[model samples]
Structures are given as structure tokens and as C-alpha cells.
Target: MPTGVALREVRAQLFGAADRVLRRDGPSGLTSRAVTAEAGCAKGVLHRHFADFDAFLAEFVLDRVERMDEQAATLRESAGTGTVADNLTDALIAVFGSVAVAIVALVTFRDELRARLRETWPAGVPVLTEAVVMIKDYLDAERGLNRVSGDPEGLAPTLIGSAHLLFADRTGTPPDRAAVHAMVTTVLGGQA
Candidate 1:
């Protein structure tokens, strides 16, 4: 929104502001005006860059998915370096943060945003799917190193499902790092 900032920068700035608002005030607080104000930009900036509020939300959700995918891709690097539970907890925290929960609430209540997202991602955004693949890949790598046993393909979904439950409980206190580690340990058959 600042002078000389590139389009990509503006987009990133807007998304960052939106994420902050969503984290602080939940989905209901996210609006073009709120995002612009948080980003320190004029209100027209969002409309000029995106077709409508739904379009902007769709783009925001897609951008977050892409970022999660990127983070998942890096899981293999941690395969043998730390406890599997620790590694998994790190990845899960990255993918299932407060912001993600807020986004889910937003899309669930907003038909236009949900429709726009489905138009782009018919398989429902692929966050869990991408995360499963990454977890499986990391598990496979660990299995090869003789650090873990069992079918990663089976465990990945279980872990993802548990993480979804943990993250979706926004009304309660979030699971702490110890709880995350414990869940990952249970999934890994005490390998942690």
C-alpha cells in the first residue's frame, strides 16, 4: 500500500493484515476496510486488487494453502534430526494455527467465499491432503533410517484427523506443545 511497493508486496501486506485481524477478532472482523486499515492503506486498494470480498478471501485461502504446502515439503529435512513427535508437532502447528481455524470459520459462514474456493479447489482446499503427503514422506524417510515402524500412509491420516480436532477446538484452550507431542507419540506407537 505504500508508494513504490510492488503488486506482490501489496498483496502480501493485505494478506498479513487480514491474518492479523482474523487472529485477533475472528472472521467477523475481517473486511476490506479492516484489512486496509491494518495494512495502513486506503480502503480502495483491496477492491482495486481483487474483484470482490469473496475473491479476495479465496485468494487469501489459496495463498495460505500454498504456504502450508511449502512448509510440508521441508519435513523430509527433519526426518532423522529430531524426535518424530517433535517434528510432527512443528509441522502440525504450522498448518493448523489459529489463523487457519479462523479462515475455516469464515468460509463456512460465507457462501460466496466457499463457492469461490470450491471453484478453484474442488477437493476442498487440500490442506489435510498436502499435510498427509508430507507426514507420510517424513515417516518414510524415518522408517528407512530405522527410527520408526508401521505404515506411514495409515498414520498420516490419523495424525491429520487428530490435528483437525485439536485445532478446531477454538472455544477451548489450544492444545499445548506437550499435548501435541503426546498425540504424535501415540500415533507413532511410542516412537517419540
Candidate 2:
């Protein structure tokens, strides 16, 4: 790119580039240089916007988490309208559809990124943590409607952890949707 050309939506463009790097190359391949290269922007563009790579990564995770909040709202609205297992299952698929799993791996390997995230999150991985809370909140809504019975607090982590495992690694494809549905059903079978 040019030295003086303005980059519109620079953060988003860089974030999209980083996400692709994380997905394609995994954490090992994700670096400021790679991201800038992938983004077709000068390396200085990234440094100019964010203090460091870790700061950019933390902001990226925060942006994704903010997006997850939209999905959470949608899921909560779905509490009484569908089979509990299916609703939960579909939500899992959506949340795990791409970035969350890779983000977990990235956070695990990057000590500085984790530390920066902890300043605000102070508890868990951003997407995963939001996922757990999303599930728990949805389950709570279902319980209130008597559509589901059991402890949402106890079940949320169980469900999210299981779902996370299903999406974590790949065999060229995500776990079969039916299999995931079955897993959710079995978990909630006693409750519903």
C-alpha cells in the first residue's frame, strides 16, 4: 500500500486478516507481519492503530464477543419456542461455526494477550466465557418457562465444554450436526 493512503475501517480489515491467519495458519502463523501482509496494508498501519499485536488481538476477541452478545439475545428469545436441545445445539453450531475454537488456542499460547484480556474479562476466554454465559442465560430462560428442568449453572459449562470439544479440531469437516444434536439431547434428556 501507499504511505499516505487512508485505510478505511482499518481495524476491521486487519481483524479480518488476523482471523484468516488464525484459521488457516493457526496461532503459530498469526503475527503482525502476517496479518498486515494478508490485509495488504503496511506493517506500520497495525502499529499505528494498536499499541502492539497483543492489544490488537485482545480488541479482536472483544469485538467477536460483542457480536456473540447478539447471538445470545437471539438464543434467549428462542427459549420457549423450540426443543431445548435443538435450540442449544443450533446455538452451539453458530457460536462454534468458525473463530471461537481458534481463538481459544490463540489465547492459550499467547501469554501477553491473555494477560491483557484478563484486565477486563478477569475470568475466562472471551468467546468461550461468553458462550458459557450465553448457554446459562438461555437455560435460565427455559427453566423459568418450565421448558427445561435442571440447574442451568451446572449444565452451562458442561454443555459449552462438550460443544467446544466437538468444534476444536477438524477432520476436514465439523462434527455431523445430527451427532451434535444427539449429544445435546442426551445431556438434556433428563431435564426436558
lDDT on C-alpha atoms for all candidate structures: 0.81, 0.89
Model 1 CA RMSD to the hidden true structure, in angstroms: 2.9
Q: Tell me the tens digit of each residue's lDDT in model 1 across 53-127.
A: 889989998887788756766788888897888889998887787477777788777888878888878765456
Per-residue lDDT tens digits for candidate 2, residues 1-192, read 556667799999999999899989988899999999899888999999999889999999899898897899999999899688889889999988868888999999999999999999989899998899999999999999988888899889988999888888842589888978977877786555
As for candidate 2, its clashing pairs are: none
Model 2 Cα shift for residue 182 (angstroms): 1.0
Give per-model TM-scores.
0.85, 0.95
- Cα miss at 17, model 2 (Å)? 1.0
Clashes of each: 0, 0
> How does candidate 1 fare on TM-score?
0.85
- Candidate 2 yields a Cα-based lDDT of 0.89
